[model samples]
Target: MVRAGARFMATGPAQSFLRRYGWRIDRALIKATKGHLSMSMVMPEVLLTHTGAKSGQQRSTPLTYFTDGGRVIVVASNYGGVRHPAWYHNVKANPRVTLTSRGYRGTFLGEEVLGDERDRLFELATQFMPNYAGYQKTTQGRRIPVVAFTEVR
Candidate 1:
């Protein structure tokens, strides 16, 4: 467990930077690192991609995901912000999604988990990335949503 003071100290800059440019910054970091940072240091199976939701336009982002029983789990922590992240809404609107990682590309179906199932997945996610606990803490009064994606044939 991260000390409360340390958690606060670390989150200040991280939250600020992520809020300002987390999408682009994390995408670039993932591309440059070739999924090394996300997979090894963070979680596994993250990619940067652009897709259209309601507007049928293009939206690109770098997100950390992991596979559990063949389902891909994604955290909408947004560092525990009050509202859901942009990609969360995008995927919610359009379940069809595309991803690219380490030279591998594919399409998948995206779905959000709720209630007890969501809680269970969130617990599993925290095991891989403890910072998620801090993110959950930072976003008080709000429930972080966890999204699951399954490959569409």
Candidate 2:
């Protein structure tokens, strides 16, 4: 079902719809289910709360995530768009964040991985969601960012 959804999401119109209002729907469903349900019903989904980069206001975004080596990984693919998502910029400016995923909720420090680490994580991300590779191809040379979020002790 998620694969089919991903394929649909790849369409120009679907992308536009998702870019506009998908997050709201995801948030509503998550809230209604108390975080037990996500739009991507199979893969782990996260609700990340971050401080806006420019506005310095609190913002939240729902994202697909996967656990690897005790770290939670999320791809800032922006659905293959040319620019990084707004959340990515916020996270870059303020690495501290709050996350709720897989029934766990806590503070985490988000770090954008680079070099071999990034390559490895991105590969793992692709395995978790194959559409990501296709998203990369559409990125024109913007090398999508992969972030690792670790619980703050």
Best by TM-score: 2
What lDDT tens digits, residue by residue, belong to model 1 across residues 1-153? 223423442467855765677656667776776555442242354773546666788776777677788877899987677788888988888878887665566788888999999999999888766668877887876788999888888
Best by lDDT: 2
Candidate 1, residue 96: how far the Cα is off, in Å: 0.3
Off by over 4 Å in 2: 1-5
Instruction: Sum up the clashes in candidate 1.
Output: 0
Off by over 4 Å in 1: 1-10, 29-42, 48-50
- Local accuracy of candidate 2 as per-residue lDDT tens digits, 1-153: 766766776788887887889888987777667678877766678998899999999988999988888888999999898999999999999999998765667899999999998999899888767889999999889999999999999
* C-alpha lDDT of candidate 1 relative to the true structure: 0.72
- Clashing residue pairs found in predicted model 1: none
C-alpha lDDT (0 to 100) for residue 82 of candidate 1: 79
